[model samples]
Target: MDRIGLTTVVFRNRFASTKPKNQVLEDELTLLSTPEYFVDRFKVHNVEMWTPHFESTSKNYLKELKRSLKKERCKLINLQSEGKFDPSDPLEENRLKAVIEVKNWVDVAKSLQCEAVRVKSMKKSYSKAVLSLNEITKYAKAKGITILIENHSDLFSDYKNHTNIIKDVPLNNIGLLADFGNYSSNPVMFDSLKHIAPFTRLVSAKTKDFSNQMEHIPYDFQKCIGIFEASGYQGIYSCEQWGKANPNYDYEKITDWMIDNIKESI
Candidate 1:
């Protein structure tokens, strides 16, 4: 059966303090909301955690986290790692660093029993990025976790680039994380989704505002879900509530409403 999940970044503001420029103070938000809180309160059985919201990936810490998830009966669907992942960086050292960092996240994914890890693409180096991702995919395969490439920014927002990366990656363990709200308009967004649907392993349904009819504004949830169904995608539609379209409304309230819309569409 298809299920719904959420990314930790959806509640980023509530997760951490944006006040401190320093990284240390920024992590204070993670302390407030945790895996336990998500499972117990939201009743989400599947979760996609953002790496920045976490402080450590030490063995003991991960062990405890795994224990907590098991206790709550929640599964870690994906681990969204935030770092400099443009393998096509002009500098060789930076490219090397990106690969190493992503590989480390793969290890963490293993510890968390996560099914996939989402990484961003480089706007500069398509070929180099593919090469680097191939290496990451090789490592992820051994750990039994998939490497997911998301259409997050710059060149990645283009559907052609997403398909190119998928075709050139040359790894079976690599796939795309199709995000609904990434594109600028409905036509382009739906077209891009169709292009990458064959490669999609997960979906990030980013919602900002809803209409009075309980439908997602700007982008139609019914049509979006139709595209997913047409593409034969049967996975969690991760509700990622972002953007400040309605600052007056609380995000949790918006999330609840989005969940209802998603249920109706599904």
Candidate 2:
């Protein structure tokens, strides 16, 4: 059975605020859930973190987090690093800065004992993005963590962009994090998933509106799982849900439904 996991983005509403690019500002009333919260609430053994939900990446913070995860017998599977870093920035100085920022997150991921750290692709220029990721991969490889490129932004949604980088780089440490719904509800989502499935190390099993009868409304969960199955992807299908999208639905119920659906499929 594929391991089920939860991403921190599922509880976006619980965060303190979304100002200055949706990064958690770490203030009172934030209601940000801790690693233990997910372990206790959902009973999941695997966790994927989106950077925004975290209050800090200091050594002490990460050390405590790792201890908490171990205490609960939960594994930190992947870290979605700050999305603001763009390795393809046209400005030479900015691109260098982006590398440093992502490198720092790589170190952070290492501290947390995460298996992989996902970085956003630079949409403007593939060559430059490859160059940037190559450097980042070297750093991540040294730290014993895989570097993942997700199908997030428009360029990454194409799938070929992801394959192109994977081919050009030719390093085992580089892989893809496939997200089912990031292509704006495109019809070819499954095909795109098939194309990139071979290179996928983890999946962002994104979910949206559900029916009153507790069925997934926005995407075909079974067919997507079939694709993953055929591709031999035996890995984490991290539940990446947005609770606020359907305010009327009980967020906890919806989350449980998503996890159950994936568990049944796998």
Candidate 3:
């Protein structure tokens, strides 16, 4: 927590208990602002905010964000440029839409004083996402944008494929935002984290609710830290806490505990 720059996500589903959007947004800020007050809290800033619930290609979307970013505590934003899971989009149209959306995001990120915007390397349709990404990477220099891809489910099945895509794109500005637990659903989590960290410009320090589990879960803190260390990864390890929670688990407490355990236990 002390040396690391952190990030938080603002998923609409995470606020389901709150009745109104206004109320939910207010509650989210309260959680954020409290860290500003924590006595022993290290300097924390630069949060990653998601894109619109809709596609970012809308003409008015950039206009709306420009008007609103002034009100939020978002001096820096890790803007996710494309987000479509479930694999239902037509390959050609989706690729075109993503390009336009990323272009719009570049304009907005500059206007909003945002540092970096994340993007997908490509989709399962190798030829399309690859083709589009290559074009974007070529143009990215003039645009002053860097693309950071997560090991997002389905988009990247393994490190070999992921590394190949990074190679094909050939942009020094482009790199991985290695989500530490991306491969947690598989037996290869640690290895995947190790392999990708060298290419990492950002990292999502993923954690599960050990407190929520009925039995002791096996997450090696030392191994996770070792991967970053061995890779010479000196970048933001943005904590991502996912999966179920229990009645006894305090969300903030869980995060603070992980920061202490994982960082110090190393």
Candidate 2 regions exceeding 4 Å error are 17-33
1 versus 3: better lDDT goes to: 1
Pairs that clash in candidate 1: 15-29, 16-29
* Candidate 1 wrong stretches, greater than 4 Å: 17-33, 210-215, 245-247
Residue 51 of candidate 2: its Cα lDDT? 79
* lDDT score at residue 70, model 2, on the 0-100 scale: 82
Top lDDT prediction, candidate number: 2
**Full ranking by lDDT:** 2, 1, 3
* Lowest lDDT block of 10, candidate 1: 19-28
Model 1: lDDT equals 0.76
Better of 2 and 3 by TM-score: 2
List model 2 lDDT by residue over 77-153, tens digit each: 88888756578877778888889988988988889889999886566767778889889999889999999998876
How does each model score on TM-score? 0.88, 0.89, 0.74
Candidate number with greatest TM-score:
2
Q: What tens digits encode model 3's per-residue C-alpha lDDT throughout 1-266?
A: 44454444422334333224444343343222422423235344545555543334344755555444444433454666554532222466766777766766666666556667777445467556667667666666566767776777646647766667788788776777777665635358777776777777877666664744432255765567678877776666665566553435455565565566556733
